[model samples]
Target: MDKEDLKKLVQKIISNHQIGVLSSVENSKPHVRYMTFFMKDFILYTPTKKNTEKIEEIKNNPHVAALLGYVEKGSNDEYVEVTGICSISEDKDLKEEFWNDSFHNWFNGADDPNYVLMEIKPEAARILNSEHMKTMEITL
Candidate 1:
């Protein structure tokens, strides 16, 4: 696939998916966990608590990776893998923007001081399918 097709593929997967695996370097090893994400203009955001271990790991190392677009039982094997540079953000407007009713389970509110967003700017991305022969990548 060409760059434009790859971009469209990325948009289709990420825009349709919300849950993904986010990884950060911890003690020279990869530390990964499930996170709810938001995408806009190809940028990724994952809301998290400021004091979480992932925050410290990201602070010590800004590079991260994420996997999105997979579902149970491998029914939908197609997915997007992203390697990106991550930074922490506490912008109130963003907090408000990313907030949703479901977040109430983990946060007191969007204004909660512990709440923060991890902004990930993709350096590289690829779409893969375990059940298909299709795969493509692009650098940004």
Candidate 2:
């Protein structure tokens, strides 16, 4: 697919999915967590806690993997795996844009000092469907 087609596919997959499993390396071991993701252009964003080991893991190793899909019995299987480099941003404007009360459940309420935001810029992505699958190298 061309760039425009690829972008459309990626955006469709992201919009159709809500949660993604984020994998990071922590002390040479793999750690995985569920995240609610938001996207802008081609960048992926998620929130986490500063106290969480995952935050430190990302700092130590920027490499990450993410999976987004719909899982239900007898449903057509569709999913995407995203490989990327990520960074932590403390930009006040971005923080405000992503803020939501629903995040309180994960951070034990909104005022939690440890709350942090992670921005993932994907370098590659693969989309898998029941009929076909394709992998594309991306420059984020």
Candidate 3:
């Protein structure tokens, strides 16, 4: 597929999937956790708590990676590997845009001080699928 097609495929995968594994580094070791993500084009956003370990990890090491769109029982399972730099933000508009009741388990509401947004600006990505057992790079 061409770059444009790859971009569309990546966007479609992200749009179809809400949960992804976000990988970060801490104390020279790697840590990964499943997170609910909101994506706008190639940029991804995930809400997190201020006191979470991932917050500190991102603070120390801004580089991060994520895996999205995988299904255990599917033969044609396709996934995207996104590598990017993460930056934390407390933008109210963004918070309101991505907030949902499910997050209440972690924060009081959209205005909760503990709630923050982790923005991943993808520098590069690779879309993998079972069809050719190959990966295609999506140009950012």
Candidate 4:
């Protein structure tokens, strides 16, 4: 696919997916975990607590890889593999934007001091589809 078309497909896949695997280097090894994600202008954000282990890991190694949009549709499903620089955000507006009542399970609320947003600014990405088996690099 052309760059524009590949971008559309990547955006479509990301927009339809919310949960994914985010990996960070910890102790010189890769640590992967499921995370809930939202994106704005191709920048991914995941809500987390300031005290979480992942926060420290990201701090030590800003490089991260996230797998999004594989929702159990077998070989037909398309997913985006994103490699990005991760940073922690404590901005009030962003916190409110990503806030949800269900988050009370992990946080007191959006206003909680421990609540934070993990922002992933993609340096590069690839659209992976089983049927197509095409790996298209995207410059974000």
Candidate 5:
């Protein structure tokens, strides 16, 4: 597919999926966990507590990877693998913008000092659709 087509497909995949596996490196090994993600265009954001191990991992190594878009157990499943740089943001406006009631379980509220946002700026991506049987690469 063309670049525009590929971008549309990637956007669709991201829009349809809410949770993804975010992988970060720690002590030269890979550590991954499922995180609830929010997207604005191509950039993705995931909220987490300040004391989490992933926070430290990102601090030590900003390079990260993520996987999104898994629909079901079938041959037609499509997913996107994203490689990017991650950074922590504590901006109150940003926190309020992405805040949801669900986050209260882990955070006291949007103003909670422990609450922070992990921002992933996509550097490259690979989209795999079982039906297509080919991987499409995207650079951002």
Candidate 6:
């Protein structure tokens, strides 16, 4: 798909689902954590505490998976699964742009020492709608 298609699909999926289940590896075991994420500049951002297990797991294994979609009891809806490599970024501008009140609860205020941002640069994303699926391959 072209960049516009991908961008539109991303916005659609993100808008439909505000919660994401982020999977990471820790102690050679897989761990999944549900988090509220906001995106900026096409980069997925998740604010976490400096000492959280998720942060350490990402440190040990950068590969991660994010599931962003939901289904009601009887409704059929497609979901996006994005698997990518993640990095802890300290970009001042990005931190400011994605900042919000929820973060304040975790950070105890802006610029809290425990605040850390995880940047997921997707390597490959597959949109699954039952038997129909499309994959968007990425570079870097």
lDDT of each: 0.89, 0.77, 0.89, 0.88, 0.90, 0.74
For each candidate, give its TM-score against the true structure: 0.91, 0.83, 0.93, 0.92, 0.93, 0.83
For model 2, the run of ten residues with the poorest summed lDDT: 130-139
User: Which of candidates 4 and 6 reaches a greater TM-score?
Assistant: 4
lDDT of 5 by residue, 64-138 (tens): 999999879847789988899999989898899899999989999999999999999999889997468998998
Residue 103's lDDT in candidate 1: 91
lDDT of 6 by residue, 83-127 (tens): 888888777777777778877666875566677788888776666
Task: Give lDDT tens digits, candidate 4, residues 6-84.
Answer: 7677777878898899999999999999999988877899999899899999989999999998788557788889999
Better of 2 and 3 by TM-score: 3
After the best TM-score superposition of candidate 6, give how far the Cα of residue 44 lies from its true spot, in angstroms: 1.2
Q: Please say which candidate is ahead in TM-score: 1 or 4.
A: 4
Off by over 4 Å in 4: 130-132
Native-referenced Cα lDDT, model 6:
0.74
Pick by lDDT: 5 or 6, better one = 5
- C-alpha lDDT of candidate 4 relative to the true structure: 0.88
lDDT tens digits by residue: candidate 1, 31-131: 98999988877889999988989999988999999999978666657899999999999989988999998998889999999999999999999888735
> Which stretch of 10 consecutive residues in model 3 shows the poorest summed lDDT?
130-139
Task: For each of the candidates, give the backbone clash count.
Answer: 0, 0, 0, 0, 0, 0
Q: Across residues 24-135, which tens digit of lDDT does each residue of candidate 2 receive?
A: 9988888998998877778888888787777778879999988887576625567777889989876667777878988877775444566777898988877676344444
Candidate 1 structure, TM-score to reference: 0.91
- Candidate 6 TM-score, true structure as reference: 0.83
What residue pairs are clashing in model 2? none
How far in Å is the alpha carbon of 29 misplaced in model 6? 1.8
